[model samples]
Target chain A: MPTIIEKIFQMHTEDKVEAGNTIWLNIDLRTARDFAGAKVVKNLLKHYSSEYIEDATKTFFTFDCNAPANTIEYANNQQICREFARKNGIKVYDVGRGIGSHVVIEEGLAYPGITAVGTDSHFNILGSVGAFGQGMGDIDIAFVFKTGKTWFEVPETVKVNFIGTPSAPWSAKDLALLCVKELRRKVLGRAIEFYGEIVDELSLAGRITLASMVTEMGGIIGFIPPNREVINFYSKRSGKEIKPVYADDATYEKEIDIDVSNLEPLIALPPSPSNVKRVRDVHDIKVDSVFIGSCTNGRVEDMQAVAKILKGKKIAENITLKVVPATREVWREMMNGEIMKELFNAGAIISHSACAGCASGQIGMTGEGEVQVSTSNRNFKGKQGAGDTYLASPETAAASALTGYITGVDEI
Target chain B: MKVKGRVWKIEKDGKLMDDIDTDMIYHNKYLHITEQEEMAKYAFSNLEGWQDFPEKARKGDIIFAGENFGCGSSRQHAVDCFIALGINAIVAKSFGAIYKRNAINSGLAVLECNALDMAEVETGDEIEIDFETGEIKKNGICILKAKPMNKIQYAIYLAGNLFRYAEGI
Candidate 1:
């Protein structure tokens, strides 16, 4: 018998025809962000006369630019989206202070065992919470815009069994980078099922950090089933009492495990998400900029870690350090606490919560000659604004900002 | 897994600030800058060995770039460039995820090698690739170290997509 992932593939491969087989798994949840809306709306306006979209109910929209009052258009565009959703009766959520799309959704939206489709490539970051979430193009999404149904070819499942407690500053991001390095780029878009005792120890935020980067490894998604940690997470934010979603016990194409207990803070050099080495390996490499934000590592927990490291210290004079929160809610929490002040006092510019410098959205660009070390998932050269980009965990990126060289926080 | 293919030529790591090369992968007479045949003949435009490349260059083409090999939109034209031109594979030091995914889904191979050299490869040298195994050997030299594919990626390659399942895993 094939594993659950194999079952998904068999079903999609057979065109959803085989008995007990389904070719495409139905998506339980769908999400879209502002970056994709302009294109999506234009395409719809061009393709259809009156503006009809499929599957609007199963989808949700959230705005991330409320806090900084970033752009006049930011608030205006969100109002338009909210109005459209309200008029169409599509579910829209903000929790007032909702921030990043992935963070807000996993905070309360995703149901276990559900397949999620999003317009952005990084939406699969929620798989760490045990959901099969992935990305699609806006045009295909237009169909989902019209029907709320997404097509899948059922991917083969690669089982990643993680064991051993991860070393300090060496959290899920380390393992994720390792996967990207060892697995090569071809394995992308494959289902990744993360298991092992260590998975249980990671906070829900940590899992999001790990799952967010699964796309770095060329896998379709990365998932660890919901446990008490997740339950605790949901218990706080939601009263709807959504249930846990788990994959069928049987059927996986292959299983791979990692013992992160001994892992160190790893970093990916410029031009490749997979070209990674321990912080020690690149200690001597000089740095020009350091960034600690984005859906992958911009959560409150990550910000606290940064604050802990930068509280009394200032970043290197030549290096520019910046931070952005995962969501406005996270930003609010940080502002209420000492971390926000500490970061600003230490000379770190606070970018708004709207994916600043993460995707193409906004903020940070490379000059004629510049190198930036960041905690974002992709390090493909010039990924940030322009210039060279080096991928690192939050701790490493923070430390590099302090010394203007890649190093661990302890060294700073 | 990583597969080594000679780069037909590099496209762009960062968006080319000055010049806009159109006949990159697809043949569009609509652009009217050059004939589709001429573009293919001189394709990859000013890209080293790009124009000289046949309709399909084989594996072992080294794609060296400053940064961001596959940046812009996800148009499978680059993948189609390899497929239609019969280029065997591509080995860039880095690649865009969308480009890498599209290449794999389409059976065109691309590998990431920060140190790979197109200068070392003789054009049309018999390149070896085992996509299932992730092995790349060019002219008797084993260059890349490939890892195993995950379940879904393997199935996509084997079944040739969810639409056609000629073989079972």
Candidate 2:
């Protein structure tokens, strides 16, 4: 009668734990990004007074946010992480490696049944592959670095069933947006286990797109139990048999059914990710730029979606289309395929694999009075820039880039 | 333990504001500042109508916000900025999961009072909170009640922070 998360917790704690119980569980993988890596190191040394870490092999420093050091402050912070990792014999995924969460997944550092923690708020994206991933502050991450253990209040699980297949132009991002709109604030502080036919048929990239926005919905993590494809991918990558955890007679706090047959491509309006609207409902809104990247929808599948829409077509004259792959691996994959050529020919500014629009000083930063369409999560005021941001799928972003306005794929 | 302080209600349109995200509390542009004092200067700088919170706030003042306060990002600076401002406690309908943990780990007082918004209270109202009994008293009259800190929260609070609690253990 244990859910997937409960089983994962039991594996880490070696005890039966229930929801609402706060218990300490051993951490399998710990990471800090450039944004807070320096503070984590400083706090760890200040408290422990030694260069000793609990497990150097399990610890890593990832440089993705503000990759390549846009400013002197970011440069100094990345240097601090490099120095600490050098002294501790820890691995560092240097700049241009892309988002830390995606890097970990591609490297097989995070997989099904494992528990990983990072400084990124979207680290819960690991749930796409059935891993228990959490984001913490620098202080909490520092403690985990020293102890390799952290206490967590087991969140009650909510089962969300995605029924029916979404037609063309309506992709995982649209489904995710619909979920956010329908289940706003209801999943707060709880875990969501996505089930049903749509979830089972969804690809790894699709699962990631859905799980990445769980944070925007105020949920702890959104888990899509590792399907056969995910299990096979990990087994092949790790050169070992991978066992996927499944909920057996597990009871959930609540269950919600979302039918996508009648759903259209959706977009999150400015100021909040949950403030969603159908793409057609708000069409023709002039857009200054469109960004296709970030941990949310920067995978190869997302690139393919964009390429499919913009193949042999040039974007609008006044529109700035920025294309950033999620990871170096994704970038390499795009380079070997027609994705890059199509995007380049489409007049898109292909940037290095880094968090572009999501973080400041990147290629996707919006100017005042500008309206941008982004594939990344979160569009709160001043998040991308002083301008307004509309969160959409790669398909919508590509379509909008071509028209210089917010346009659904079907409209074009 | 009892905490008495003036209230700073985070409100909009005559109602408590909900979803006061971390970016609103501490904008991402100033994420590089690691010092608590430096973080204090930018508290609520991105939030509309509260851009001058850092300058107008007084020490030992308590904040009242609506549901899901501190909802975005896991940046501890959001909690640190308030602490740097010498805030007594933050009473909200609820808090973001990571934000709540960051608050407790940093030894900042965060209470959940569902009725705080409905109570007859306004900014500058004097209120006393009894940590032991989860009581909120305004002018010696019980107006609302909040969820007191749990065992782990109280222990960490008493010990100053997670690091101190770990040392004592």
Q: Each model's C-alpha lDDT?
A: 0.60, 0.91
Candidate 1: share of reference interface contacts reproduced: 0.03
- Alpha carbon deviation, residue A299, candidate 2 (Å): 0.2
DockQ of each: 0.07, 0.84
Q: Model 1 Cα RMSD, Å?
A: 8.9
Model number with the top DockQ: 2
The segments of candidate 2 whose C-alpha lies over 4 angstroms from its true place after superposition are A14-16
What does candidate 1's lDDT look like per residue over B1-169, in tens digits? 3344554334334222211122233322111111113323433532334455554554345433422354333333444544555455555555555555565655555555545443344444445656556555766666654443445556655665322322243
Candidate 2: which pairs clash? none
Residue by residue across A307-368, what tens digits does model 2's lDDT show? 99999999999998989999999999999999999999999999898887787846847899
